[model samples]
Target chain A: MNREIVLSAFDIHRSYGSADASIQVLRGADITIKIGEVVAVTGPSGSGKSTLLHALGLLERPDRGKVLICGENGWALSSRKRAELRNRKIGFVFQFHHLLEEFTLKENVMMPCLIAGESSEEASGKADRLLERVGIIHRASHFPSRVSGGEKQRAAIARAIIMKPDIVLADEPTGNLDADTSAGVEKLIMELAEEGSRSFLLATHSQDLASAVHRRFSLGSGVLREVK
Target chain B: MKQKLLWALARRHVWSDANSTVVRMVSALSIAGVAIGVAALVILQAFMGGFTEAVATGLTAMNPPLHIYLPGGGHMDDFDLGAVQSIASEIPGITRVEGVLEKPAVVSGAPGTVSGAMVRGGNNAGLTIGMDLARELGVTAGDEIRIASTAGVEISGMGRVLVDTIVALAVDSVADFGLEEYNSSLVILPLNTARDIFRAHGELTSLGAFVEKGTDPVEASELLNSALYREYAGGGWPVYMSCIPFLAFHGNLFKALGLERAAMTIVLALITVVALLNLSSALTMIAMEHRRDIGVMRAMGLPPSGVFRISILRGFLLGGSGAVTGLAFSWISIFTINRYFPIKLDGTVYWIDVLPGVFPVTTALVVTLLTILVCLAVSTFPAFSALSRSPSEALRYE
Candidate 1:
């Protein structure tokens, strides 16, 4: 509770239609994540968990609310500035490992650093180190199409964290993997959170995964509530 | 710095998995489209330009290089023939100068073939008729001809004196003047005979200056004009003289041809625009196919501007390479067509026996750059539109 807040969403409201036929997705959802903490957001199908996560990640703007990262208000910043902040301060893992099929796994992992204007040599070096840490260094040269789902997810995670962001957002990171693979990914996520000062905000349906986090929340009917 | 990163990313995307069948096929189709457009434009433009040049050359061959005429819209009789001849002879490029007495006359052949002709002084004594005129008059070499100048009837103090002098001369071979109008109305005689018939002693209609082979007629004409102006400045001039370059006589023809070339270039450029549109479509598909990857990049902190640049770079590669290839193909086609496979044309109709092709460097450069710019513009529209969507919108489902 006394830990430093790395990322926080305050009264986020979002909808997905016109005023006459609107489907309210995230109506005043709020959460604060501290450094090195793992917080999980859980909900049933179509329960606006992804909407809340997207708004916090600055991937989409809320109808009315603010997303703050490291004390900077994302809503107040221009889109360009928000993107820069996202690149420098936030990491993202998706339900499906969205590795660029044209690039090799190493290049995919090195993308964030590359996007941040780092030299290829520097980006590649960091990518190699992260790939080895994630135990996927041997598959670095293989393209995404040639990799397994688990390997692809690992590479995505490496890319997400490559910029050394302050917070990481995972939306069903292990959703497409098998039981053993999901367990492996969950272990990796736990290990990454333990070893660094980075905070983790996870939106998942897996109670087992959510139980391992420091705090958990259930989002339903556009409302967020703390759960034991 | 950001551009370097985006460029690197774009380059990788283009080359990576380039061996894919769809990618290879699209790239090939795009390049071929551009090549065909460029080659077609080059050949068509060259043909137009070459035709004009050939017509100019043919006309130049037929007309005297430098013609000195009275500016006051009358015969050259008022010009001091001796002084004009002297100045013409002093001109450096002028190979020779001829004094001609030209008048409208009625010519009758022994076969009873009569034609209205402009009888002009020539170097030979026997009469020379243009080929068309000979054909019309039914006259050939060795035929006796009589010429009468009706223009000689002057209203003098001796009350309507007809200084009608008829000359009898044998017909020589026909001359080819390249123009049907001139060839059909031409009759040539000795200088003394023309002067006696016209009854204007020591009076010449115009002085024609022939330049050396390979000399530019316009430059020679300019030199002659300046010299003539200097003469007028020095003393009393008999009349105002105008030095006309041979090309001036057919100025309207060249002007019409130039206008046609410009209109043709603009029309044919549509082909290149079509090719660029193909390039635009290719980029659009690529942007669509890469939507997920774009989302990933956006998640990593790439701004929409970065996304925009990446899309534009992809278009540039496709369009730039295609244009270059097209231009290269055009150059080769022009050289081959001009060198070994010249298209034949009828000299009577087109004024040249063969169609000529010339590849102007400036035109090629302009066309290629324009195609590239067009490709960029088309690509930019789709890219900005697609990239304008939020990353969440693009990645919503997956």
Candidate 2:
């Protein structure tokens, strides 16, 4: 299958606030992921798990680091190029599901494809397939507000992979759901990862979710340590 | 395709029920504000334009489109009426040319009714008195009135003697010139009668020239002046004359109307500015309320420029809707007022019996475009403010 490394972050450093009174979040975080791999990043509260994900996802710039998506240096690219790279190569699923309330589940799933300049008919067709694959095809026409928590998360997952990105960065994807719903979402994630088409980088405090992935890392003191 | 997505995002954000009630209400108020401001400016311009047009029409009704007089307002003695007519006839758009003499006289009807009036002498026979003069003299059409002219006065060896000339004429018509001064004092008579009564034979005050419809009287006057100068110069006569257009003769009244329109435009433009300020506030509020959604969209890989474009598009939608609505409302209001409920005015004061309301299409278009520009300009600050916050910062709490 020629599973090549699709994403790599080297010695990332990020912080908040001014230099005089700053809160350093990610001091020197590093990670690498290959295609068709499911990796988990585990950390306690106040750890830099989400910060690392944000840095790698291109949503936030690191003070000192290199985020390589598909082996391209994202930080060195212009903001526009970086945005295009993010739209085409990386997708995100936040803890809150974060489905746009104004759009139907199908529309939310089609957004990344649309942003990537795909035709609506093509995007719509892909979205429907993804929705059915995620087992939320019945709720595809319902808005985010009208869908259940599990269904919204399923839609978010469907949306993250709509553009066939190299990696999906999930930050506590099931953090806001109940145990059964979380388990169901977790099962859905594992099943999608089993298809071996794209990689998954999941950041969660749940041990069960952390243990279910192919590889696992523990983040503390703004550093990552391989545990699996 | 990206532009289509951005547009879709903007449209959905603006019309989404997910927005807070406060945001929706503020948006509605902003739109209403713009509509009202545009409507006020348009209606005011329409009425002012109509009023100016009405006044100009009234003034031109009583005065000739062009008048030729001797330099320094002197009466012409032994004037060549045929030569002037021939010169005027050669010029295109000069419909007619006629010599006229006017003098002040006292008009009396019945035993005690007497009024001082200016007697205008033209080629037309019979006496046509002004409405106010006829009222003062207790005369109407078919009534006999005596006009006594004091233009023939002499100084004798003993003392100054007044050779008063009185003539009786039947009132032909009572004319309302829509002007207070003209209606209250003018008296029209035949040229022969006026010359005999004023003892000014073979003398004419001025030559009035009427122009064709849609012809610029100023241009016609200039042509006439040039023609007359060339004619007199060719004859080796050093005669000077002045040709005055209707607008130049009544420049003050028209200038006052123009000044009023300018002043009113400035005042009313302030209303539009205030309305746009409200729009700025509303857009700012919307930005604040939608901060989380903006974060989500950004996280979804929407560029900062795309976000800015969406914000601008929202402003265009809101402001464009308001401007169009205001234009339609103004047009309907003007049509209704002009067609069904025309406002009546005092003829003596306003010079027209009914106040006019005209829809000025060009002015409306200008107002709409300016409003949309202001809307976009105001939206810039909020759009920039929205872009100031990082996507992570906005989504931190969520």
Candidate 3:
């Protein structure tokens, strides 16, 4: 069967450190996720899982590669234009649930819309709706520190989807959660992928969570292979 | 629009977290430093300005505002006194004009009563000696004094020939003029008496014009020149007359004072620079503490310029509040100093009874702008340092 591709990478290579003492993170990694697809990449520690997620999220430039969002080459865009695209078209969830401590959960969720130049009133309404959908509306006014780890992750997921981006990238989204919280977050991610008509790309070490996605890839030794 | 978002975040960072002791302490100390710097600068400047103004006032009082005379001491013979007085009166800021006939003479009291002193006769009817001069000569009011003028007397081997123009006049009350040299050895007599002693009839020495208070001397001189051209230069009087402002008559004294005032202001402004340095250190601390948050902000699509602007706005807010507080301090202190704590100075030395203060709006405005600019400059290093590394690196770490 055929599906519309929302995000794809072709022959991406990334490395760290100077040439004499370099560590190759991704020799040549390629990925594709269709609309409404929940794809997961399972990898062990030091397997370049987070690096691949960062390159896909446009947080860092892959040394030699092409990243296309909705068939548009991201490398061709200027830095400022790339920032704008990230603000409007891409969302991210980190392992630490990087919610700004200065703002409440609702404000943190509304940040994407604010960055997109939406009015505060409009952003507030959208934030409230997303919080309600994620079952964290009760703690909307509470700060990140005041919430539990599971609740903070839920808020992070809400913030990621508030913009209704074409793709959502999660780098070890459940790495810091317990079994029950991780299971709950996994269910939320799949449900949002269906309801929001967006692709979700998750990198994690949990076999159960990886099995829940429509497709699973194992990353190790600087290569990606289907997990059957 | 992006800038608005960043501005909102900056505002949140500035105002939120009241419970954090570190943030509260840093902000309070920064504001206090700026406030104290501003207050010290303004007060020192006002005191310096007041001292200079007081000295200028005293010097101008001793001499009239405008002294009109010809170059090379050319005597005025049968000049147009009416035209001159009318022209001077027509000028703006001109208050009074007087025709003065000056002559040098020797004045001595009764033998064994007082020694002789150098005298220059003034417009007063009788002989009026300065208080200090009277004390030196051991004379008081109602005393007889003899004055002599040696216009053409020949000195012989036997003795100097007295031209016999000696006139005795009763002493009037002694006056105190603020200058030491003038008060010590100078005496005044009627202008007509001076003319008689000098054997000059119907010849005036110079014209003196006094101006209103708070008038700019340069502007007053220009007005005098305009009046002269309009009135006297047509069928012109006997010779050329130069209108010299009293302050210009002793230019070097006030020039030195002006230079000193500028130097002191520059030195006092260094205090504000120290305050700015304090603010910069506090901002650097803030940046270090918020490193993770800044990384998150950059990941949230805040452009580099947006990040840079947030830091600049932070400095502006901090320095702006401090400058206003400082101006308030200056305003209240000036009022209190002028009202309650009047600083007295030695009248003989400073020529004023109490220290004065003037708060010009320009000084406050210029200082406010300068402080904000300084804060911006000092904050640049730390603000840019927040984004010096890759945002991805910041996210990868903590």
Candidate 4:
């Protein structure tokens, strides 16, 4: 199994509003993430961090420049193709531990594999292993609304990694947690990247979460610069 | 693998999870509505068809398939009975032919007067009274009636070709018919009497024949035409064929019955449609209430189409279930009543017994198809309702 670069966002810019009222969210933000490297993005408020991650994730198209995932020109692809990549290659985690409230944790984790056309038996097995790995195995049968905050967050992480994707892009992964739970989540995120050799780009405002990663970059005024 | 997952998610969304069990209930209702509507429609159609067939039988029973009329200027002497019989035998389904004389007679009953009745005189064996006219005239079997006509040659003051009119004394009775249209005074006498009353002796006014059982009417008619051409044309009398099949002869009566059933179906089907509306909202609300689940499903990588498919299935299921239940109920009730319950009509009032409910398959099929189509349409809106929110938008809120 030969692994190569997973996702690359070339000098990208995104803007909104017409003419004079225009606002640039990301300008000339570039990042090429390898197959298994974990990259942490940290910035202050309104620093265009989430926007830059969105471009790299292919969820949002940049007004200029191209995005490539697994050597396919993602920017030029159809919306359906983009969705396919999002389903098969990349995983997303947002703040508030956005686990679907109606589904059990097991159903939530098994979703990615199911979308990729894996058999139910196989997907469930994979989901079980992932939940057990993340220490939420006991809560897998419980709905998201029934689970505790920390448990929900852990489930979200398990869901992101269930597909064994090339890149996992997370926005404020531990922003909703207390100090102690935030530390636990950061530990989980670090372990996920190291053991699976999966690339990660986690946007955060937390000091400890950013520092734990191998490399950290800061976003400011529509640009990303390496800080460490 | 992805498609399977997407399909599962779609199924769940449409069929629903615990959080929005009410939506599932709604979908169930939708399926039931469609099923019932469809089944009812089919059953109704069958009954209508059966009724039409039954009525057509009675209408065309005594009425011949074709009537051969002598051209207006022709001589009655040229009618070769033997030649006409041979030609008719060559045509399939022409079982019987009779020479007929039609007369315009004023029927005077003690209770009523019916003027200008186109009295058709044939052998007493084949005459059917217009039952509708009988009810209008209030005459019945064994009743006495008088018929009068004037012939210019009967009195010596006129030329030999003209006779002064005189009253024709005839004992009349009520005509027997398969349908309710006949109760009036009609005189069905022998051909000799018909000829004598009309005063067209040896000058046959019309020649008629009946189609034999177990033969196609059109083929028989064609054969009859060929035979008639060979027989009568050489005899110097041109006889033209009048084609009046059972359907063409009695179309109006059948149409009236059909329109009644159709109106009943339309009015009844609306009830199911209302039920389906509740079903659609229930399904859509289920989708909405389960928004987070949908988001979770999308995160699992199920596509939008999967979402659409599942919801529609749920709606159909609901409608179908209800429809079957309703249809089952209707079937038992109708069957029991039609078989065991005898509704007879008074001879003086209604032409027959109770109006029958016939269950035919073709009508049922058409109705079922329509019901399914309507259910499908209702489901479309609800199926797509939850899908508009993308995985991000859905998950972002949660």
> Which parts of model 4 have CA positions greater than 4 angstroms off?
A1-4, A43-50, A96-104, A138-146, A175-184, B1-7, B19-22, B25-47, B60-85, B92-235, B240-243, B258-352, B370-398
Per-residue CA lDDT of candidate 3, range B306-381, in tens? 7778787778777877888998899899889989998988655665668888775788778878897888887788
DockQ for each of the predicted structures, in order? 0.46, 0.56, 0.39, 0.26
The order of the candidates by DockQ, greatest first, is 2, 1, 3, 4
Q: What tens-digit string does per-residue lDDT give for candidate 2 at B310-396?
A: 889888877887788889999999999999999998876786778899899899999999999989888888788878877777677
Top model by DockQ, which number?
Answer: 2
**Which candidate would rank higher by lDDT, 2 or 3?**
2
* TM-score (all chains, Cα) for each model: 0.77, 0.87, 0.78, 0.69
- Native contacts recovered, each model: 0.76, 0.60, 0.47, 0.37
The whole-model lDDT of each prediction reads 0.82, 0.86, 0.79, 0.68
lDDT of 2 at B326: 88
Model 2: which residue pairs collide? none
Candidate 4 local lDDT, B76-184, one digit each (tens): 4324545566677766567877776666666655465655455666656533345555555555545555555543245455535444334444344455566554324
Error of 4 at A19 (Å): 4.2
Best by lDDT: 2
**What is the lDDT for A203 in model 4?**
94
RMSD of each: 6.8, 3.7, 6.0, 7.3
B304: Cα error in model 3, Å: 3.1
**Model 1, span B246-352: residue lDDT tens:** 78888998999989988887877887778877877777766776777788788888888888888888877778888888889888888998889989875556656
Candidate 2: Cα lDDT at B397: 42
